[model samples]
Target: MEKTNVEKLYEWLNEAVMTINMHEDAPYLDNLAMAINVLFYHDTQNLNNDIVKKKLQTALENIQLEQYDKMEKSKAVQLAILTGMKQSTQQQHMMTPETVSLLTGYLASKLMAGHEKIRIFDPVSGTGSLLCTVIDQLQNPVEAYASEVDPTLIQLANGSANLLEKEIEFFHQDSLRPLLLDPVDLVVADLPVGYYPDDVTAAAYHLKSDEGHSYSHHLLIEQSINYVKEAGYLIFVIPNFLFDSDQADKLRGYLLEHAHIIGLLQLPETAFKSKNNAKSILILQKKSEKSKEPKQPLLVNLPSFKNARAMEDIMNQINTWFTGFKQN
Candidate 1:
């Protein structure tokens, strides 16, 4: 069978990355980043293998990366990144699944309409998957910004954006720390779940625990809200236990004061390995006179992505809610 362009791109890149991996002592993810750069610039100055160089040049000639659309380019690189993740221990850097990112993108597209130009942010942009995916979904020109603390993940993310030719400004600092970014129109993140160890830094957040370490996810939500303009929306993939934890009251209090609940979609259990790790998509709008709570929130228990008929039904219902949302 003839290979699709995406498959071809992934296969060629994987071969080049493997060649680099054979010689480099660095991590596989880093090698994949270098391979992406080499593909981006068509520069093999660092790669001394004559045979692999010819093969890469041939792949570039046969496959026009420019001809591929943004989403296709993202998928190709995503395939490469998944290969790297399997060879490494950086499980925390996992990209949001394509299905979930598409779901978020659909919500963002509806939320961001009518704005000709807008700023968007992702506080924890893992490999730029969800951020870039959402950006591809928007019709307006976007000034995209993302931050990540991990060196490998950031490097891989930069390569992913570069290959897709989508310009995204990135910060390599810890997101919980003060960011220089101004308030943006929207914020999106696949919120990392765990306790933040920085007692001093966590102290500054309103969601900070009075006693022990603060939940990193809670602190992230607060920080992301701080960086969004008044009335702007925030979309988070939060764990199911987010509100059931011991610190739930304080977090709930912070939300009531700072934002309005927009929607919550409980994702299918099939998305996670265990029931305990299941997550839901939560939407919020920053508190402002202009952004009042919707009379009816869009609460849903999303069916498995594989269930086409049921998935379509949920989307139709969501569309109906969005129609009402606009009028509200």
Candidate 2:
């Protein structure tokens, strides 16, 4: 098969970034941000060598950024960042898988279909994968906000959003902390799973543990709920063990007080290397006077992405359920 436009674009970016990385030895992901900045600004940054500067200038002259659409641009960004992430020894930066991002985006588009315009936020927007995917998938105008704690990932997110011509406001801080943000109509995130080391911040959350570190995912959920409008929908890619752990009761209690579960569709087992690592798409609506529980939540065991026929059947059923649920 011929290489896609996205692959060609990614190759172009990778070569350009590698040229810079070989000199500066800056982290590879950081080089990607620099490459994008140079491409947009038509100049090099912090590079003293004449040879490298000339190469970057020549590549900038030959580039046609507008030729690629959002899908191509976003995929290229993911590919470049993914390559760098694998080489890094510093942190385990888990990206939301492309299949999972596509599915979650589709769910979000449907969830907010009736609204002509809305605000959306992602508490943990690593590399802008899930949030960007959702923004691209939606049909209406959106006000997008995202926050990230990691400096490298935040740089990559800003660069990618700029390359895609998306107007996003990002806060470079820990999302679990108080954000200077207003409530949003929707929230979509690939929740960070693990213990939150910030005991001071954890102490403020209702989901905080009695002993030791608190579950970061639970605190993020609470934070997201706090920032969503009443009856607003949220879609999260959460670990399968989210509701079955020893702290499960605590999480359940928090949800009951603040939100209503609309659905939980377990992602296909084959999506992950281990079944234990498999995740689910959890759809929630923050509680309010107008919000009512669906007759029965859209519980589903999703088929593998490769099984198109089965996946289509399941989606149709979900669509029908949503139609009725919205009417109720």
Candidate 3:
């Protein structure tokens, strides 16, 4: 699509976001609904005006009727960031499908059985989908910390958190920077892909590319490892392209050295229907004092699905793995 045309879509979506911002109930839903409508209209071959209209009506009806207040400001921000994301291709800053899967899977794994005082942090939180899911799935994350370089996204994330009634500390900074002085028990994040950030700005500190070069993703992995205390677990969703890449190998080695490689799930392509790309989830836990040697990684390649069920199954498996580990 032409940039101008995309801009028009942005205008329409942003207007919807403004409307949502004004609504105290389901603030993000308005923008989301508008986005769906735009997609349906633009989908051409798959266009369904009737379906789109029905969906919009349903969304409108579902939004809780509530008074607007200062608290609903974040929802407005979410709409704005989403508007930027739709056109971020020009900026070479696309949030890939694999990243979303990894974030969702991480939540599923941690929140399955539920717990008290659960602390979660997304060092590279985007629109805060993962964090939002975490808050909604489990009762409440006692403490949630998230950081993103983009001010727009940070605002959106914060807005989503408010809408969901999830308490969180939103940080608008690069995840590569030094983090909390104390470590948390669980860390869930997705490292960005190569190309856009450039080598100088990439945050891969714990990885080495196949050619023996470093990438930004390495930085994210290393920080995650360092930010979690002993017995703490870190789950990362990485691109397949990085698996055999030199940096991928370096990442694997670094993680193995500092932690126990518990499980490696090769995710299906369909896990990310919004975009095309095969991804994998790497589950690492700091070597417990009880164990001396590193254990082999349990690699599981999830089956592909044409619908959301595939994601649900993947989430189930992740939770099961965590449950089985606690039992063992």
Candidate 4:
């Protein structure tokens, strides 16, 4: 397929920013690129090089992207911007495209099987890639929402959603803190993993602490589970050790008591090439008060493949598993 003009323009804008030699000015440059993308998507008539440069400067000065006119495009410009952000030296967090695609496909299938409109959320929605992809892939309509801590990423996320003309509510705050929003149908995220030093919040939840270090990933799981509606799902990409680690016993016990494990797939180590740890996909359904005790969850051991062929096989297996689950 031929690349759209918006995509071509984004390439030029990214290359232009790369030549600027201003590391401290990278955020401004990123904002400039995003604003230019928004402008181009809305008004393609005035997209000459000179005009774009001037408008980008104006946008940077104002620190805003123009509102998008409603027009659906082939590829999301914000995703291109996200790629550029990942390439920049300052980008500290990112999930591989393979992981995102697999999760999106699985979620799309599950949501399509049901008839009701659903609400989906991501607590640590960096760049909004995961949320956007899931929304784009859904066969049925959905209300999408996400929260992020970094203002810059939130700007990029909102800008990308605008360029795609997708309606999504974005929250600029830490997702770890307790939320007062209504419960959602699905919670999906590639959760951040590390030893969180905030003991106060950990103690508040009575989270298990080991060697004076409480894992942030565990905390997120416990917190995210609370946001799901009865019989709703929580899908997360997390390190494999959470399944059997002594430190995670409390979290594991909590999950077993309150939710039904839909499935767990041990992904290829290469699936998260950007990080040094092995990862797994965990799918859990929040149990209804009247529901009976759930059966044991399906556990799949996926073959390790770094390329497209392997990813396809993994996705196929996942789809088949979902199909079987839906049938029963």
What is the lDDT of every predicted structure here?
0.89, 0.89, 0.59, 0.66
Candidate order, TM-score descending: 2, 1, 4, 3
* Residue-by-residue lDDT tens digits, candidate 1, 1-328: 9988888888878887777767667777888888888888877766676776766676667655677776667878998888888777755867788888989999999999999898999999979999988998999999999999998999899988998888999999999999999999999999998889999999999989889999999999999999999999999999998899999999999999999999999999898778987889999999998779899889999999999999999899999999999987
- Per-model tally of clashing residue pairs: 0, 0, 17, 0
Model 1 is weakest, by summed lDDT over 10 consecutive residues, at 55-64
List candidate 3 stretches off by more than 4 Å.
Answer: 1-84, 90-115, 139-141, 195-213, 273-276, 291-298, 307-323
TM-score of candidate 3 relative to the true fold: 0.65
- Per-residue lDDT for 6-74 in model 2, tens only? 997898889888898778868888888888777666677656777789899888777788788877888
- Candidate 4, 149-191: lDDT as tens digits: 8776777677667656678998888777877578998888888
> How far is each candidate from the true structure, as Cα RMSD in Å?
2.0, 1.6, 10.6, 5.5
Candidate 1 residues lying further than 4 Å off, grouped into runs, are 46-64
Taking all chains together, each candidate's TM-score versus the true structure is 0.94, 0.95, 0.65, 0.77
After best superposition, candidate 1 residue 245: deviation in angstroms? Answer: 0.8
Query: How many angstroms is residue 238 displaced in model 1 relative to the true structure, after the best TM-score fit?
Result: 0.7
